[model samples]
Target: MCPLFSNLFEIMIPKLDPTVIYEIVVIVFLACWFIATVLCQFRETKISWFIRYKIDLFNLIPLWTFFAPHPGKRDYHLLFRDKITETDYSEWQEMEITEERTFWSWLWNPEKRDKKILSDVVQSLVSSIPSFREKTGNLNLLMFSTPYIIVLHAVSQCKKRSQNCYRQFMLAESSGYQKETKPALILLSVFHQI
Candidate 1:
């Protein structure tokens, strides 16, 4: 070992034998690996407010795929919409989102059942936009589809007045689309182009 490393080790592990040094190195390596793995997992799974904001921002990029509703069993709208659609969660007990897997086979994977639910809800929302427009006409509606408070603040900053729009938007703040009508209209237009 270099004198500098030897000196550092001498101070850090003063009483260490060769066997102890080896064990110490192994333990530190394992600890670093464990911490890195945990951070990776957190980055992958932890959906933070920043991530939600990013999702909302991407939602406005005029990309139809971004609006592509989740094709799963759970309707995210149920928690925010006027009425919840009753669907059998068991139907999605096997649904998985594997890249190589066939659609039919993925429908049986319980691990992905929740994803299926979220997808289905988004699909339903996309489908319902046309119906809403048909009933309400092309009003200057501020619809908030996301369930984030920050998204609401962003919407308030982005949209102009129509107190009615704000009330309607706030009514479903926790669950479904806030300014969903416009987004739905946007989705409809995109869907037609596709």
Candidate 2:
């Protein structure tokens, strides 16, 4: 142990052991983190505004604005199928993104960003229907869009057998928050070589 660390702890609390002092420091840190996170919810107040804007160094509070202004009540389903040969097309299978949660998932989730990115790209692709209609003469222009490229890349990365050489993907909307809502077709892509 460094002499400066020991000296500082001794100066802070005279008789306590260094191990007890470390535990105390950790407890205080967690308490402050929890308190600040809760207080950040009331950010319209003066103190909360200060804590959220001025002193939050590590971005400890998450802005939970997933549903604001226009909340998405429908879910977009991406379905793809692989072509084995000229006329032997496979069944359309949905690209299922499961939100698997383990005991420690809140602390370390690798798939969290993937889910968000895919959803955003899908939303953009659905919104690109107008562009697809405008460029009806050339399908290449529709395929070259950013959202289309991203979705194609994601679909091409799916698990496939050795015989699968080409892939096609489509976006469909379904009722996510409300089961009474009707399903609709969004966009269908041409088969592209993998």
Candidate 3:
């Protein structure tokens, strides 16, 4: 025998029991379920499509992308500039979105509502861009979309509301956690009067 198996005979190996077989069966079942779930994650994949549409009658297999599908790997930056006039424009200013976390936030968090609302609004708007383009076949007409209108109106309502001033907001993406990455423009809105 090889040196690795020299002690194999010396160690008493227990015979397979009913409990051991049951444990193995459970483990194998779990493993298969995990594999099927992963394979059925993305609808674009041929396997995923077939699995979802063909054999799944009662829809047992969970088509989940684990916990977070598109996790927040980057920071969202909503920057706005005031167009004081047709000829004059103010410097871009960052909209304060993030709030400092407190230990008591877990028990009593009221201020988080505004942050959550802003985040959800932005998320919906960002997600609708591609769908809007495909539906209308014109990017310029995207201004009519509900999400765009909401953000535009919300921004227009913020800070120093007056007839003389106009506001333009842009959504930029960056990795605040990553020092090397730079901010990239995601969406820019037309100037709207306050």
Top candidate, metric TM-score: 3
Which digits, one per residue and each the tens of the lDDT, describe model 3 over residues 1-194?
A: 88667667546654458987888899998997787778887655887787777867888888566437677666676778898767988888877776666899999988788667766677877787888789888567778877678768767766754557788989888777678988899898888766
**lDDT of model 1 at position 158:** 35
Best of the two (2, 3) by lDDT: 2
In model 3, state the lDDT of residue 93: 81
TM-score-wise, the better of 1 and 3 is: 3
Sorted on TM-score, best first, the list reads 3, 2, 1
Q: How high a TM-score does candidate 1 get? A: 0.21
| Clash count, one per candidate | 23, 0, 0
lDDT leader: 2
Give lDDT per model, in order: 0.38, 0.79, 0.76
- Candidate 3 residues lying further than 4 Å off, grouped into runs, are 1-67
* TM-score of each predicted structure versus truth: 0.21, 0.54, 0.59
Candidate 1 local lDDT, 84-194, one digit each (tens):
123311110111232233567646655455545444444544565666678779522314444223323423343333333321121121223344433121221100000
Candidate 3 global TM-score? 0.59
Q: Report the Cα lDDT for candidate 3.
A: 0.76
